[model samples]
Target: MTAENNGTGTPPPEGDDDPFAYLYRQEGGAGGSAQQPGVPRRSYAQVRAVGERQYGAQAGPSPQAAPGQQPGSGPGLPPHQPNAHYAAPETMPGGRAAARRQAAAAGGGPGGPRKNRNGLLIGAIAVVAAVIVGIGAAIVFNDDSGKQSQGQSDNNDVPGQDEDKNPKNPKDGDKKPAKDKPKPTGLPSRTDAADATLAGGATKQTEVAKAQSAGGAYVGGMDKPGASVTWTLKDIPESGKYTVFVRYGVPGKDADSTLSVNGKQSDRPLNMSNFAGAKKGDWEAGWAETYSWIDLKEGTNRVQVACGDSNTCDFVLDQFWLKRGWVK
Candidate 1:
């Protein structure tokens, strides 16, 4: 018989006479219609299998079942595979093991694929941070080195200033200090005959007190015609005419002597006509002779006296005087 829904939405109970009565009963209902006589009844397991094939797979009792699990196998459900389009939870945040540990810590059980993706993102952030830090460190190091080099350059500049201000010790590039120039001796100067440069027959010997010379010495023995005497004058104050006074004596007649200044001879030989005879030995009677003004150069000069060609024209030379003013 067909079952009718009571006013309370409940079906009537099945009759004791029909063994298939329970098959037509609604789940959790009081009763239902009996199965038809021509059709066979299906078991609970067969009915569930047909339902799974028609609709999508539903959640099983436990989530720990391995893949390809047969129905009715123990308590666990079949292994779950997430959609291929989504990134696996294991490859998201951390490695598979670490992700599993995190999931376990969060009470997510295990085998979470989203955690692995998070791990990849964290690793990327760490790498970017490291690169940034390295670049910053390199920039700082370069700046420090540049500052050191500039400081060294500044230090080098200090020495240059010192070299310019203090000239006692000079550096390689510093200019040398100027040397002091010699000053002129304004007063009259004299040279003794003994100090003269003698050549040929001229010689230095002791002379008597009457000799017109100091230092107890004079240049004598200049009897040969080729004998000569030279005196070096230095530190001349100015270039002008100077009078040369000679102290000399001739044992015989007056003599004629040649005078050369700076290798240039005088225009005329100096005539020695005012000779006084010697008392005893040669040049015992000394006489002072004055010459006309001669040109004197400023600085070192050579004054030379040579005997005339005749041997009798030679005389004893004691000393000479160079005065700035002319002789009256």
Candidate 2:
């Protein structure tokens, strides 16, 4: 074998060899210096063992020196030995043990103590409960407002409650009560044709049968223009609208007369149609009824039926009457 090969024939370095020796040489370390020309390099096994060394073990006996050399003398430096004060990370103060303790204090590490969760859970529950209470309060408030508003609406819908609570002024005693207005009693007040005043050739006649007037009397001679019969009504209960019903007879055809109330002429002539369906000149069978609306005073009023220039007044008046209100 060649002396440079050391009888190993250039085998690959072992796994435990220092791969970073070149970086140590660049930084000019004494341990990384170039070897002397004749000194042999040490093998990795002679340099340092791979496993941990026992720092506190008893020392073994030293090897005998060469015959002429000293006991500690060698051709090159001695093999690397572990320092006497070196310690493992697990055994040193403030190392792996301290780091594990710090991790446990800061909460759970990989498998250390677990953090507290009850506080967060309670806070979330309290928030939900508060929300529920707020919703309940809102519902109650809305219900109360709705009930109050409904009560006010009900009060407004009651009829005449305000009027009953507030009476009329005592100073207006002369005014009639609102409920005292006249209503129809279904009984009409009657005036016979004999009791009416006649003018312009109008005269009372008893010849017609079934007149409905006292003694079968009626007013006649109303065919001439300007002839009229006037009735002065009295003892009216109140001043209001009234209907004047007249009972009259015709000669079988239709006839009409002008009607005036309280001396004011009516806008339209009074209708005296042949409602009885009698033959011509059959005055007794031609008895029929007609009505006109008029306003009357509280105590007295006058109603007149006349033969105007435009009237066909062949009909005779038998009776006149008053109903309380304007009616058909």
Candidate 3:
């Protein structure tokens, strides 16, 4: 009965209203009907065995059941017809086989090959480390090369380091001769005043103490006019200015005398001041020195200490000395 008949015991037209007509249509068989209008069809046996196909095996030909016999049933059982409404769970959408295929694609099922995640991770890390090491080595090599170049440049720029490049000459190594130093002037010449020629009642005496002359004698009695002591010095080294240092003792008062060099009177008188700071009339403690600059000849030069008309002569002469230069 067709769907439109609604169990009225009337069959619909051969192919127009039969819902299961595609299941019964046959090709290249005896008593086969015309082609159906809907999808092309397979036999009932083929449709029933589709769910039974193995996952990896190819489908062979299905065995046709004998008439009035059940598929896979022994002879004691009754014959069973194919149910057109029957559907296998594996053949439906979202079935177990499709779920298993999804599981395998997601790498969770037993059929899927697992990948070594740790090995991939470790290999990536090793490649990155190798790259970093190569970069570091290049940097080190460049730094060392730069330092060596700088060191070489510094060595080349320095002077007096490469002996082979700039050899030393013997004349350049020899030192210059030192200039000759002038000979030192002769030492001072000391003459005792007592040994000098005395005139005009200027006599030599040993009465005063602390006289630096020989035998502690000194020239005395030079207080009057025309009294004088003359010294004739000889063997002067050069014709230059000389210092005439006179050692004299006073009665603790300042006195001075006229000085003449080589028979020419000096412009200024010899100063015989009482530098000792002694009490008046203390001749022993009044011993002091005086000097005068005079121009003399290289040979013998006569020096005179006289009591002139304008002189205040109250000093006793002890010693007269000649220094090469004018000094106090």
> Relative to the true structure, how large is the alpha-carbon lDDT of every model?
0.65, 0.73, 0.76
Model 2 C-alpha lDDT per residue in residues 1-328, reported as the tens digit of each score: 1122222334324552444332222211233334333333443223323222347746553333344553245554244334344655575579997867767777756444433466667889999999999999999999999999988876674554453544577686767557864653343368897789999999989888888887888899989999999998766767889999999899999999999988999999999999999999999899999999988877767899999999997989998887778898
| Candidate 1 per-residue C-alpha lDDT over 188-265 given as tens digits, one digit per residue, 9 for 90 to 100 | 467788888999788887754566456678787777787889988878888888887777776645666888899998
Of 2 and 3, which scores higher on lDDT?
3
Note the residue pairs that clash in candidate 2.
none
* TM accuracy, model 1: 0.47
Q: In what order do the candidates fall by lDDT, top score first?
A: 3, 2, 1
TM-score: which is higher, 1 or 2? 1
Per-candidate count of clashing residue pairs (backbone under 3 Å): 16, 0, 0
Question: Mind sharing the TM-score for model 3?
Answer: 0.43
* Candidate 2: regions farther than 4 A off: 1-188
Instruction: Encode model 3's per-residue lDDT on 53-161: one tens digit a residue.
Output: 3345455544444455445454543334333455455655889988787777888776455455666778999999999999999999999999999888766845645
Models sorted by TM-score, best on top: 1, 3, 2
Candidate 3 clashing pairs, residues 3+ apart or interchain: none
Off by over 4 Å in 1: 1-106, 109-120, 123-131, 151-155, 158-189, 210-215, 234-239, 249-256, 268-289, 297-300, 309-314, 325-328
Locate the minimum summed-lDDT window of 10 residues in model 1: 46-55
